[model samples]
Target: MADQHRPGTLGHYVPYLLGRHLRAGAWPPEIGKRAILVLLGLLAVVYGLGFGHMLGNHDLSATLRANFLLGLYGTVFTSTLLVDFVPSYRPVQRLLPDHFPVSGRRSAELAFLLDLISLRRLLLGVFLAALACVPGQQRVALLGVALLLGATALSFGLRWLLTWGRGRRHPLVAAYAAVLALAGAWLTLAATKSLTGPLAAGLPWLVALLPLGLLAGQVAGLGPQFLNRNLVRPALDTAESQWLARLSPEWKAYLRKTWPALSMGLAFKVFLLVASSVMQAKHGSDSSRSIFYLVFLPVISFTYANNNLYGYLYSLTLNELQRLGLTSRLLVLYLRLAVPVLLLDCLLSAVLLVALFPASTWPLLGLLPLSAGVFLALGLWGSLSKAKPVYKNLDLMNMRNNASTLMNILTLATAATLYFMPWWWVRAGLAVSIMLTAVVPVRRLLSNHGPQRRQLHHRLQSM
Candidate 1:
């Protein structure tokens, strides 16, 4: 039995991969060491200032302590998602042999490790561990551990979501819902400090252990729950609705390739709606921090996709560009593909505003439009200036698809304050102003038929 199990154990594969990575000097496959060094340096400086400011606070209040705890959780969770999702730090993955004798749980686990081990990821792990040193914070350590475990379990569900097994009845779907609910409850309880009796003492332990148990069951016990149907197709007609069929072929094709990100964004919007409503109900409009939460509504969808517009469609758009150069046709196609999402984004933002910040509803009517313009312009700029090579695998964990990391930062930063001066005329004027600014990127793209898209798409299929 020991001999039989050895082949399926991670110990065998991890040592091999670790040896290979160390031999190869730990350089990430698609990116260079210099770039990673630059980014890590910048991040170190920023993190140093930010954590120093927070740590400087010696006498923490209950609310401030609660806020810090929540912020720590959000930071750990978001950073894990962001860092893992982007095409970074996976070196030995490409070195896997074709006939390697890996199977079942072992195969899945090996695939994960192949992607996980890299110099950048290890550095990030160190950065995350430093959160424990912050003064007056005790739970940050356990919470971080529990969060990493929960996040791993959540990835299985998220991965299944990008595949065919995404309906309500699917086991992964049910698991996803349960995990999300549990996460919400965990934060809410942490904030309210109301985990009662024995439950309160064991809650952190449960959060840490339960996810590990769930992941073990899924990986080792659940046989053949993988979703691998319809990996690639020219048109997504199988899943198309009447509304989608009405679209032109070019539009439909573009939407077909990019539908998953849009769907993911829509999924986030649903959660935000529920979470925002709950927050508003508990705190009401009286909370000074409500607007800060509500102000991010326009950006939720952009985080998934819009901010990386060109990279998201590089595979398709490259062919079009070769035929047309960087002409008005390219700009028109970009606008056409973007308009519907922008409209939908506006509608969603409007709904959230009305639900939570009802008074600001009319004033912030231009919020989504302004956000759309700003990001579209910024995304276009990044496409020209800071694009990256990405894959088209529709992996649940991989959404950016060679997106611009700079634009990602700018997108969030811009949205954080987009609705800052949330007065009717002020927002409208800003919206118009940004829309006019878009012409600059349009001229930039048109004036230069840059070959970045084509070069980037060399590794991609025509889809």
Candidate 2:
């Protein structure tokens, strides 16, 4: 085959090539359409702000500039290391057969270049560009851009080192401890103005470039050496199946049917929780003000579960749903089950808040109503929409959506309510909202349109 990395005579047909590749398999068309909609929505927001004079504020401009720079640097740095971190791409190393017609070096290069053309890179670029449009101090913006670029390169390089080092018998625990200590010292210096002088001002910028340099060095030296290394496969265990078998019949059935989806959901939740905990531990003002972590942790974890479960439910082929003769009952079951699951999530969140922020326990409890209400609203929306889940192994699109205005509004509203209202009253209001949102929607869905039911039946009949 011709080199995949090299431009062909149809260089101008890059878009066509991409389209063909994307459409070749069982591609979820909805995901692409939704992604385009989101991009357009963000652009509209930026243009609207410009017209409304919202971006005219000096402070806003300064913030935007800083964020833009930071975003750009972060994007590039993250993108460079993406191939190493993303598991799906891990197999690329083994994909190139040793006896292939092409030279080994050329094959590796092609694989690396193809990895660079990933959807992750494209989305990162779009997001970074959007961040750049945010108004901010020009210098801060410039600095952010520079820092983002530098950090990205550095991250890529460091990731390569980490991968290489993982093969050795080094004490990773000690390395982690050292890193934590260094981070603590850096934060202390920054907070105490110990590093505020001329020396300190230039250090961060310089440090950012180190990653890029390291990545370059790795690419030059270690790239070929690592390319042909034997891929290691971890041993698999079926212990979970034994445990699942011991559960109640209903629970066992659920596990049997949805284990893969559930496992993926649980893994994603654990990752987020751990990441949030680490961030809070590092940056939180004492352990007392860890309310943000408490608020976010359970909510996100449960949201991921709900979304994933819905995805698993949808993954059942239309024929399968029909074969079971349970489509109506299942939909009803979904609506019924959503409440307790969401309530459980709310209760868990409240407990975390109480544990972390006893002083603000009353206020935190008050926020529960709001959280529950939002969850119920979203659940109903998802159910009624009955949109097929676009189950990308990596949910890049959903991640982007979570960072958007709709999510921002929810966060802001929750924050504002917590700030202004008395704890007891806010709690009361939250309770009322949850009941209204959840109950009202369920009633509406049951009463008004039986169209979804009819369609389900029609589809089954056709099959």
Estimate, for each residue in 69-92, the C-alpha lDDT of model 2 and write its tens digit: 343444454444443454332333
Relative to the true structure, candidate 1 has a C-alpha RMSD (angstroms) of 7.3
TM-scores of all models? Answer: 0.62, 0.54
lDDT of 2 at 438: 56
Q: 119-216, model 1: which lDDT tens digit per residue?
A: 44444454555555555443555566566655655554345334323233557666666766676686678667776678655665665556556666
Give the Cα lDDT of each candidate: 0.56, 0.45
- The TM-score, computed over Cα atoms with residue i paired to residue i, of candidate 2 is 0.54
Error of 1 at 361 (Å): 5.7
Question: How large is the C-alpha RMSD of every model relative to the true structure?
Answer: 7.3, 8.5
The lDDT, on a scale of 0 to 1, for candidate 1 is: 0.56
The candidate scoring highest on TM-score is 1
lDDT of 2 at 49: 41
Cα deviation of 312 in candidate 2 (Å)? 2.8
- Candidate maximizing lDDT: 1
